[model samples]
Target: MSKKRKRVSRRRLAGQRVLAHVGVHNIETGEYKPVTAARRYIAESGIVPPALVNVRRNEHTTDRFFWGEKGLFSAQYAEENHFLFPSLREIVDRIGEENLFAGLEALASDDWEEMEEYEYAFV
Candidate 1:
């Protein structure tokens, strides 16, 4: 007789503000793809692939992150495309932890004033 395995629910990723919206970077080909639509597609399919690497941003702490099957819980996929977590982490680090969200959000939303308010030299 086979023992029954217990199933646990891990869907607690809603409502958390994702400060950095990173894309899927193909390390080998130097290609990058946005992860929004692909994430939607994966959600609808119900099958998670291993070869994806997206950065996992901490809601409260932007300096901390991890790597996993999906980009939400951890970093983006890596099995298929060469992993780019370290490099990505470096980029984030250069941007500074305190200003990570403010900087990225400003650029993503085209809110230059926000950056200016932060006293970012870029603005």
Candidate 2:
């Protein structure tokens, strides 16, 4: 079962400049590789990870219960679409809030088993 995200009264991360590395997650393997190197891997392999949300600063956000990073899911958008999400909240809009978080949490932790749990899981 997936954990429920908390409804915080206010987003504590507002206006905070956090140190973060850009990276991509293999939706199939739940593996995370930092960018440039990750870009090369994707190009040479011709495989696109379902999501690219691998930022280290937001690792703190994941510390709450699961590896939950609100703004991080955009890494995938950046990789696939060649641009970062203008609004991270849109991740919720596109993938659905629960799915964006849960899907990403699975990727962030390198949980290949959890990733493969899906019926359409990639080989």
Candidate 3:
């Protein structure tokens, strides 16, 4: 008997408009810096295990990049490797593992008007 291959659905974000450049936030100091400045600071200070927060936006929605130990990851990646990320672990603890994906989907489908409340700085 032949094994059937599972089909994977790919979501596209090609039409999204970039609202801002990549920004780095220091988890300990709560400081936000542009990518270039963050790189310099990380190099000079030798910040242990530097991670980057990348944002992708469009006229309608936004997507955030989660920086893992291995590399940049999406929400799905964080779901799969929740153990590797502190934030995701905390979320799982609060919301339960099963509901994590549903919550993320809801957040992603939320109205764009709510996103306008905060000003996004273009680095």
Local distance difference test, each candidate: 0.32, 0.31, 0.37
lDDT of 2 by residue, 36-74 (tens): 444444556654333343323243432111112332233
Best model per lDDT = 3
Q: Give the clash count for each candidate.
A: 8, 2, 0
Tens-place lDDT digits, model 1, residues 1-123: 999965321111100112233433222211223344334444555533332333233333221222333354333122112123343334446665455434333222333333235332220
**Model 3 lDDT per residue over 1-123, tens place:** 999975322111100111111235442222433334434555575544324443323344434444544545554444333445454344445665344333333323332333323222121
In candidate 2, which residue ranges exceed 4 Å CA deviation? 1-34, 53-123
Error of 1 at 34 (Å): 16
| Ranked candidates, highest TM-score first | 3, 2, 1
TM-score of 3: 0.28
| Candidate number of the best TM-score | 3
Order the candidates by lDDT, highest first: 3, 1, 2
> How high is each candidate's TM-score?
0.20, 0.23, 0.28
Give residue 112's lDDT in candidate 3 (0 to 100).
32
